[model samples]
Target: MITDSENMKQTNANIAEYTVSEISGALKRTVEDRFGYVRVRAELSGVKRVSSGHCYFALKDESSVLDGVMWRGNVSRLSFVPEDGLEVVCSGKLTTYAARSKYQMVVDAMEPAGAGALMALLEERKQKLASEGLFDPSRKVPIPFLPRKIGVVTSPTGAVIRDILHRLSDRFPSNVMVWPVLVQGEGAAEQVSQAIAGFNAMENGRPDLLIVARGGGSIEDLWSFNEEVVVRAVAASQIPLISAVGHETDTTLIDYAADLRAPTPTAAAEKAVPVKVDLEFSLTDLGRRLSVQKTKMLEDRKQAIVALARALPKPKDILGMNSQKLDDLSERLPMALLNSTRQKSILLGRLSGSLSSGKLQQAARFNRERLLSASSRLRPISARLLTEKKDRILVAARMLASLSYQNVLNRGFAMVKNDSGNIVKTHEGLKIGDKGEIVFASGSVAFETSSGMNEATANMPKRTSEKPRPKKPNKVNSKVDTNQGSLF
Candidate 1:
């Protein structure tokens, strides 16, 4: 029984005899040592290479990623410095690091993630500068071709300074003043901005032109020139400016804001200076053309003077023309006077002949003869004819007096009329009881017809009922006949 109990105890102890480290070591070996290592590619991010020959960073992409490790040797061979935002294709093997107890990539090699990230960075910078109106063509200044003084703003230690100096010396050999500035750092943008502003503010006649420049670098390293403050300072500068930043493939905000943008620092310096040979040739051509123009102008003036002298009239010619006009008038005067005298003499002779013609002579003789006869016989003939006419007129007057109505009435002959007022000459026209008018030499009376004129002539006895009538004169003639006819 004792032997069996000891054996049981030994078996139990053996079954429970394992430590935590031992178990964990077995599990690690089983999980990690069996799988095949993988080589993957990703973009680099959060890159940090330490001095211990190890790099700790993330290899991530849009969908999935892992941590990465690069030994210092591999990192040193990179053509470009790795940064957080740089896209890089990494080749590495998947492995578990025992010390850190984490699965990570041990990278053997890296290359740029290709052109996509570079283009993306360029577009982002473009939009940033464009929003600030730095790319506006209107904001560009006019650079002086042959600047009197050129102001250079750049890193003192950079190759850009060397390039600019050499180009300027070669092209124009101009006087230049360099304003040193930090091209990369915390305050690098501000330093570049201040340098530009300082050159503009220089009291002793600011530089005729300015050149803001830098050498090629990575996007981050060249970012100072892309800053808004630097861009605005360049735009606000009074002097014309040239921007020489980075290589031709790289652009910054200063490029857009400057008056001129050169492909390189050397190009910017070339733009600032004029070629001495070209200027000298131009001056010579201008001088020759000016001399020809001066000669032509002198000839024009001489011709004008000669023309003016030819157009002027001489005094003697003017006097001779007037004298000829006077002589013509004098030669015609006597002929005009003689013609007028001849016309007057002819008119007088014609008038005298008309006065002595036969008709006029006959009229004169008749007037004289009639005048003498009238003077001798006019009084006696007139007196005789007047006496005879007066005697005849007296006889006719007496006959008219005897034939008038009053004279007939005085001789007792009265007129009577009928009822229609017609003269009643015979008694047959009378009507009994009709009223009638009887006219006397001096008066008239109306009577009712109770008696006739014939009765009046017949001397009828008065009727007792009739009105009384005056007695008519007895027609007894004694010696003289008083009734007479008219002498017309």
Candidate 2:
């Protein structure tokens, strides 16, 4: 018989050996091969995003849980942020984490599982945005009665856009700019949000009103309008926005955030512009009313003038008394003129009798004698005034002579002036070699300053070699007496 050790050795040799990593790797391949891809419905739990942009979460129902991982690229594509307790359907391939030695669903796409789940998520999101005041009534702007240009955000090939154009053409033709974007699938939310912002950013041909429209559909098909980016963009629009995303019974988050909401795309167009015929009719009616009012006012004024005219007396009756008074004055005028002429004639005769030639000559003699007597009195006063004027003139002449700078020069003083003809009051400004003049009563002398001369000698006149001449007092006195004699 073979020994026990030998049997154990044979058994061990018969089995294949494997390392820890090899086993783990083999298991990962087997799981992937069996279920390459899957769609799992479960409530989200422990949803966390790390700094590296990778999302980690657990999908659990009542009794079991499965781990899920989404790479950075896929995480960025998510329409809504993942949160705990949100029910979602994840579409991904099966994979394994070697480090943890656990299997996980490598999520490429995720969405709310059903209409109920989506509605719940939408309600939660609506509450959150509402709390932040994004849906406040005060935040909404008034829609324009008629927009100059209308910017539309919708699919170019859809019926929604055609309906909007048709309605606008019938109501009021306007400039319409279509920003075509995907309405339903993968990147639809991003495109819709960007379209809203793009219209606001236009510098030229910018729309005064915006209409975000899409045809009616299920919640999943219209979920792009409910995205947070799209909703926030609608709220923050500078131009007024009208959301017409679905049929009358359907609603979306954009309806709450938009400046105004219309049940259908055609309704949005109607709200944007008024009917052309109706506006023309209104203008015509207003014009008619204004004309009627103007005519009525003129007629009332004419009637008032007539009433006032009747209250006054007749023109002929008002002038009758004045006319009679004028007639009476006319009758008395000729006789009064005759009586005045007669009285004037008598007075003239009396005056002429008194005024004879002798009386006239006597009056002339009297006036002549008076004139001679006045002339005799005026001659003495005239002579006295002439004597006083001469005396005053003599005194003024003496004072002027005393005050003259020539008199100061005569007392042995001299004045200095700079080259510029300005009086030199002090020697401080006189530099050596500077040219100037010195003035005395007799004459002036030009000279340059020298270092050898002191300040005291600068203003003094040079001495002459001849004897000094004396002043003639008798000649001045004789001149004064001659002036006095001439005045007399």
Candidate with top TM-score is: 2
lDDT of 2 at 467: 65
Q: How far off is residue 173 in model 2, in Å? A: 1.4
lDDT of 2 by residue, 48-81 (tens): 9898989999999999999999999987676566
Query: What is the C-alpha local distance difference test score of each model?
Result: 0.71, 0.82
Off by over 4 Å in 1: 1-115, 184-187, 217-221, 317-488
| TM-score of candidate 1 to 2 decimals | 0.44
Q: What ranges in model 2 sit over 4 Å off?
A: 1-17, 33-39, 45-56, 60-65, 70-84, 91-93, 316-488
Give each model a TM-score: 0.44, 0.60
Per-residue lDDT over 123-147 for candidate 1, one digit per residue giving the tens place of the 0 to 100 score: 7767877887767888666776677
